[model samples]
Target: MATRRYLQLDVFAARAGTGNPLGVVLDADGMDTASMQALAAWLNLSETVFFVPMQDPAADYRIRIFTPGSELPFAGHPSVGAAWAALDAGLVDADARALVQECGAGLLPVRVEKTADGKRTIELCTPRRQALSTPPVAIPASLQALAAADAAPVLWSNGPAWWLLRANSAGAVRAFAPDFAAIAAFTNATDATGLVIFAPEAGAGHDVVVRAFCPGDAVNVPEDPVTGSANALVAAWLAAHAALPHADGRYVASQGRELGRDGRVQLRVDADGDVWLGGEVQPVIRGSLDW
Candidate 1:
């Protein structure tokens, strides 16, 4: 068995341990797809990344993103996490401010910035198409539809489709209790990934609070602490409704508190309506995978 270097990371962490966890295979050179799937299941994180060399000269690297259940076209945390790992591993030039990442969704750009305090932040430019889907047929007919009157129920997608809904307040969003059975049924019937709910935040720093849930079927995670793609959809929805004011097209999103995670996702809406999601990643565990 070849030894593969692995890194465990906490993405969007406000602190060292508070964020969405990811398992990154630093050098997945000859690993097969099935093996990677099994490895991801063994790791059992929200997602994992396998870094491979990019054949295209324009791309700095290529990443394969996987969930416990299946490989994904694209995911937010893995991109950010992988970017940090790429830099941490000295795989890319330290002074490069922008790098292209080729994934299942195609090549996307990542912005790297180092703060004055020595914290590194990475942001990924969202895919060109952000979808606002109508209610899916998978939702059980008997199930009570959940959505804020103001926000309505919107299925948003940057890569994987997430049912982006809204609650009246941050309290409701945090306090929401879901019926997993119904969610399971919904996911089985549709290709959509999961649900992401949000509400207006309290205090000053953040504009919205978020919680993500995926019923077992396509994906088994019940609640995701911090989600990058979901927040991008949320930002798009908010921008359309004028729900959250984006001064200079920048907004802060608060998530993962319900699961005891303190995650902060930073969003930037470019003048061209492009949404960029970013945050700091905390490297918690580093080791090797003997598989």
Candidate 2:
């Protein structure tokens, strides 16, 4: 057993507690996978990340992400939170504007920048997207009411897989009550991580609203407060279908309201059609882990 630096962070938070929480363990170089998984299960957050020394020359650091039940190739909130933790722990140069993260999905680029109000923000460039022609499993009848009239459900993969659907309105997204057992069964059968539904908002401060329901076979996270990767895939779907509500291919996503958290995710699709996810991260706890 050894002591390791640990941080609890709120990613994509509009404030201190209104975002998804992530547990991060630093200097996790020698910890075996079983040990790491045990620590993650004990933490019981939606996801926990272990920061290890860089395994690839191109990366500033490497991270292993785990849920209470299993590990993931990549996850959005964990990636964003891990980047902030790396900077806060002095593992990366304070002045560095960018970083490369090595994870099971491979090397992903991260950008550090200051918001117009001068608050620091972190953004991750998602991997190339893979869209499935049809959902691996049929959409459950229970969720059919939430579907938008004009859009058909699509499945997208960027390390983790999610079935993307358009909702009729932001209110619908917020008001949705999911059937955890059915959703879990669908995800497990489809080999997917979760399902995401999004809708464009008109007068709200944010451009869209999104909700993710991920009930894995091993763990049951009924709804994610905020999800970066799902939102990225939504952006890709919108851009590819010429359905971008915003002319600039940039929009803010509102999430977490149903769970009593307020999360805002910034999404931008560049001219080359690459999607980037950005948001503010807040440190909630700093301590050490003994494992």
Q: Each model's TM-score, in the order given?
A: 0.94, 0.95
Q: Give me the displacement of residue 151 in model 1, in angstroms.
A: 3.0
Worst 10 residues of 1 by lDDT: 138-147
lDDT of every predicted structure (CA atoms): 0.83, 0.87
For residues 53-127, what per-residue lDDT tens digits would candidate 1 score against the true structure? 787788898999999999888889999898889989888987778989889888889999999997789999887
Angstrom error of the Cα, residue 115, model 2: value is 4.8
- Residue ranges of candidate 2 with Cα displaced over 4 Å: 115-118, 133-136
lDDT of 1: 0.83
Superposed Cα RMSD, model 2 = 1.6
| Candidate 2 global lDDT | 0.87
Per-residue alpha-carbon lDDT of model 2 for 199-248, expressed as tens digits?
Answer: 88764668888999998664458898899889999999889889787889
Give the deviation of candidate 1 from the true structure as CA RMSD: 1.9
Instruction: Kindly give the number of clashing pairs for every candidate.
Output: 0, 0
